[model samples]
Target: MTPQSIQKTWWKEAVVYQIYPASFLDSNGDGLGDIPGIISKVPYIKSLGVDAIWLSPIFASPQKDMGYDVADYRSIHAPYGTVADVQTLIDRLHANNIRILMDLVVNHTSDQHAWFKESRSSKSSPKRDWYIWRDPKYDALGNRKEPNNWKSIFGGSAWAFDEGTGQYYLALFLPSQPDLNWESAAMRQATHDDMRFWLDRGVDGFRIDSMNLMSKHPDLPDGKIVNPDEPYQSGAEFFASGPKMHDYIREIRTEVLDHYDVMTVGELGFTKDEQSVSEYVAKDRHELNMLFTGDIVDMDFGPNGKYERDDFHPRKIRTITNLWQNAMPKFDGWNTIYLDNHDSGRSLSRYASDAPEHRATAAKMLATYLMTLSGTPFMLAGQEIGMANLGKDYGADSYIDVEGRNYYNEVLETRGGDVGKMDDVLRELQLKSRDHGRLPMQWDNSPNAGFTVASAKPWMTINKDYTEWNVASQLDDPESIMAYWKQMLSLRKEHSDIFVYGSYTALEESVTGRWF
Candidate 1:
């Protein structure tokens, strides 16, 4: 289909690339990546044919969840850079015609944020309702009990007890990360003001983090337990895609997004079989331009979730793509295509072959799948180089990702500290944990993977195979993964008709053994 025949929106035809700032490059040799390092790479980014770069939160943060815990939204994190540096980086990228997408993490805010600080100061404080504060439930023995059965995604009760105010605050992720009460009109206006803050500064777009998690059940009730053995019924059952989500989206759109020409994509945090994703991005809905669905990524997880899973099968992935594609043609909302990101393990290891012999080929195959899809394809940094998962030998001490360490500890505690059981969990993590994608980029064979000075220790450990997989080694090789990615991009640009708008048809195939 020609541009005139199909949807002609810039976002629909554009490709997005996500950059995990801390691991991309360390300019000051502080062992943490900074804005200047990213500024230095603008030319390389432009070369990838990606129209926009989706930057993971670079806001002032405590680094508890690797910048997800924002202490201040308007200011840049000191480790990353000063606010001036961000403006310069934006100018440089814009100068090169590359757009920027900021990660909007409005589901929660760092407890250190001024709003939360005042909210927790006293029950009668002016900002007390900014963050969710519920009276604690007391047990028969007078012990303080949680208000609800909601569990944090980071492996504990979602409600954090605050003895100072004698109330529990809701934090779906971590104690330091408090969930914002969207039910409060004040909070809604505050979030809208924040979006305008960045828009005024000229960001091309925003990938709304935990988008489905904003609206929550008013009374705070216990969700139906899917598995009696687990701690809580996946808090998503009660809050995600809640009753008032569409209202909130439309409100935000009418207030901020509609005024600007920027692209808006929401992250659907939970799984819903219905056409829920379509509702978020349908043009008539006046909400989002597009949304991300993870059902495709979850196809590899077994009955026990990512824990008891063995491997990813291409056939299953194909089925997931077909399901999403065919499910929403009527709703007419676009899809956000991706296989890996800062949260998942490397695609080469999880979805493709990581074996030395077939790494590049499998990488190309996965790229083929991502590129041919009729959606806005997003590529995580380092994927173009066929970066595989970090080695399985890494232990708990080597883990830098907050979520990974927490999950590892959770698995160990559930097994009663059994070393063998811990090994299984660690092994599974090596194959599929979020940490796998957190390793520093392998720019060259040099120490620190050229991510930092030789003496500087990266925030996360460097992959052992950096020498063989670095970008310096693969750039010009015809059979290299980077070359394949470039070729795939070229193919899409050359024939947008087939790759961008062609009706998807999954080819039937069967494989009994491992693919070579």
Candidate 2:
């Protein structure tokens, strides 16, 4: 590692535990977890030995994309709690010596938001420029067409036409969640104000969501069709890690972030340019502290996309880690290490088998990589307990995720709409569903897995293996996955240099085939 790159910071040393509040704990018996639930579990969070907590989007939203769609940036969602409740949660978390990292979702806002509603009202609305609304293209005979060939991340045209405004607005996720125009000075200032809102209220930092796609090309251009078999080509090149991404990040840092003693980790979907990624996290650059990259996690994508079949390549994990760690300019850029997140599937089930023969050992191996890596480590809520998938039958009744539903329906369409006959489709979800990580956090072996009241319905299904894989049971067993995670966390504090700054050296393949 380069001498100048040996920079030290509290964030660089933190062991971040990501909490999807809705699945963590339910204190009010609302069938959904809330801020108080998190507050009540601060002791539990601290017990895990993590220094900081990163909460997913809790802002006032319609829950269209499970809180990624924000209606009001300043207010807490009613389902979670009130603004006062958030203040108390922050204070209590601080009292426990744990830092709070709020999810900063500036890429898009809910369609119900005042700005979007106003923008949709008329073509000449003052807030019109706040979103990306463009006129349609014309063919030889002037028949109306979409502005560009760009496709949404959620499997549709990126453009959504509004009859009232006579133009199509861009929404990369859902029609209800319209993409915000980062180019607008007013929009950028408003975003800055929102960041200041939480910073003033004592949020330690932010986990910027969809950070790469915030800035898109000005002309709304078409993307190259990489795969002809796929319905919609990925337009990420036009938006993700865009030309102005670094420029905008610098401006945000100078005008907003530099004023506060805070750290930021951008949710940058896998980028090809190592030089570009380093610029975002370099210590000397006025940009993000670290960033979430999915290259290793998404390595299994087959001919099509997420749902396509591809055998898991274990050795590729080391390849990705070595690339990023060495790719950092002078090793000055920091990387965020994690095997699972709200969007990614569970690590125990994804990277390792949950079978009786390999369950605990597999968890240990993954945790070894997660904690021993030379970067900040992050743990998903139920990962420490060795939580497995809920099951394979992701029929409409059991499925709770929006992206999964989109992929499921698309796959079903290709099979004549008879989903019950498609065993392969169901198996794919069993192995790769993001909901595997979103299952209710197993606190105990209660009927509701101690997540909510037995009678109340959880927002999603709970893993049936909670009987064997839960906090209470694991806490008592020294050999349990949870206990192993705690021990590793303690060790991380002792040998912070090796875990936080040491350069990684990939070992050669062993004849015994023990590790990849």
Candidate 3:
């Protein structure tokens, strides 16, 4: 298809910036980021030349898994500020001509959510079927056991035995985040209502979190053991692209999304097959407008998943990028382009060098790759200033992400709690932990990296090199990564037809260590 023949939409011709609120900036001297902090940076965000911002979850929560575990879908967390603050933020961004996409985490809710509370009140409660609950299995000697051997993406058993309800509830992530039952009409409607609430309040769209994991296998059978050393098995096969997955998404589109002129990007969890992804994003599918691919990020995953190391290879990324670039447009589907986000290590450290002498060049090179891609590019916060990963030398106490903490505990248990035996694991975590990306944004070289007042401690550690790599130092430099990103974004907007909708043709098939 020619570029002129492609469907034209605002999102297709735009770039998105993702903001992880907690680490973005602190407005009050409370050591935590608030909506007002984001409000204060409207001019800074506008200067980037991006079209929209994808704000991470800020709904009321117990914060067990940060704000992803929602206790009140319509309310904002107190640390982040009130609902009134979000309205002001929306108005400010819109006034700057920048759209906002809220993170929609409907696959699960905090165990503290009212629905979950009632669901756990009793086995016969009216809302008992609102969540995934199964009777406990018993051994030959009548020993009580979890319903299945499913392992969580965060680590450990996926099922948590609820003594009050006498059933095991599914929590694919943390125990505090119980998976919602999409089959329940009332529950699905409630989610749709929440979406409408945000849309009514002026949200331009949503980045649906874990969109593909909404439906689980009806039978809820035991998962196959994939790793010998791990106690639980991977249940992704039975849950990821389940029988009713597309049906549920289509229903959502028909019920809520179709009514609004909004952009929807679903986080396609554990799905890599071309056909599976196309079904979710193809124009005629009536589902998500686009989908984020998981293959490129998981390319370096070794036998033990993301924990074990595999030497980085550019050829793998080249193959995956080429496949998607050439394949997605064939089905009238689209992709969301990005290298790293709050969940992964910084791209400069993981994909290129973050060394003192090479960091700026590498960041510009990465920015060029993203801008020239045939999709809507999404830039992570602080990526343009050449932010990097915390190296292997940092101690274990610096790691605070749930996934990283769980891995640390697992390694300690396997190695008999020997601190000496934790060296290799610590090194791996240093390179791979999400905490590296969650560090406070380096606004300036001041104490606390200018993320908060010097007297107030930031929620997470500031990157030690923030003094050298920060926005204040690089914004005006003509050769800086931030400056280059600004130029590239303008270039992309100038020739959106070619850069965003143009066909891709690889010049070399056997290339090594270089992305064409």
Best by TM-score: 3
Q: All models: lDDT?
A: 0.84, 0.84, 0.89
TM-score of 2: 0.96
Model 2, position 227: C-alpha lDDT score: 64
> Residue 268 lDDT in model 2?
82
> In model 1, how large is the Cα lDDT of residue 396?
65
As for lDDT, the candidate ahead, 2 or 3, is 3
lDDT digits (tens) for residues 1-516 of candidate 1: 543435667788888889999989999999988899999999888887788899999999888888889888899999899888988888998898888899999999998898999999999998898888999887799987889888788877898999898999999999999999888899899889988898887888899999999888888898778879876766676788889989998999898888887998887877546467767877677789877777655656667567666566766776778787766555777778898888788778877688998987888888998998888899999989988887766776777677777888887787898867677677767776787777888899998889999998788788989999988998778878898898899899788877777676665554654533
Query: What is the alpha-carbon RMSD of candidate 1 to the true structure?
Result: 2.0
Error of 2 at 19 (Å): 0.4
- Candidate 1, superposed: residue stretches over 4 Å from native: 2-5, 226-231, 509-516
TM-score for all models, in order of appearance: 0.96, 0.96, 0.98
lDDT of 2 by residue, 240-281 (tens): 887788888999999998998889999887475687777788
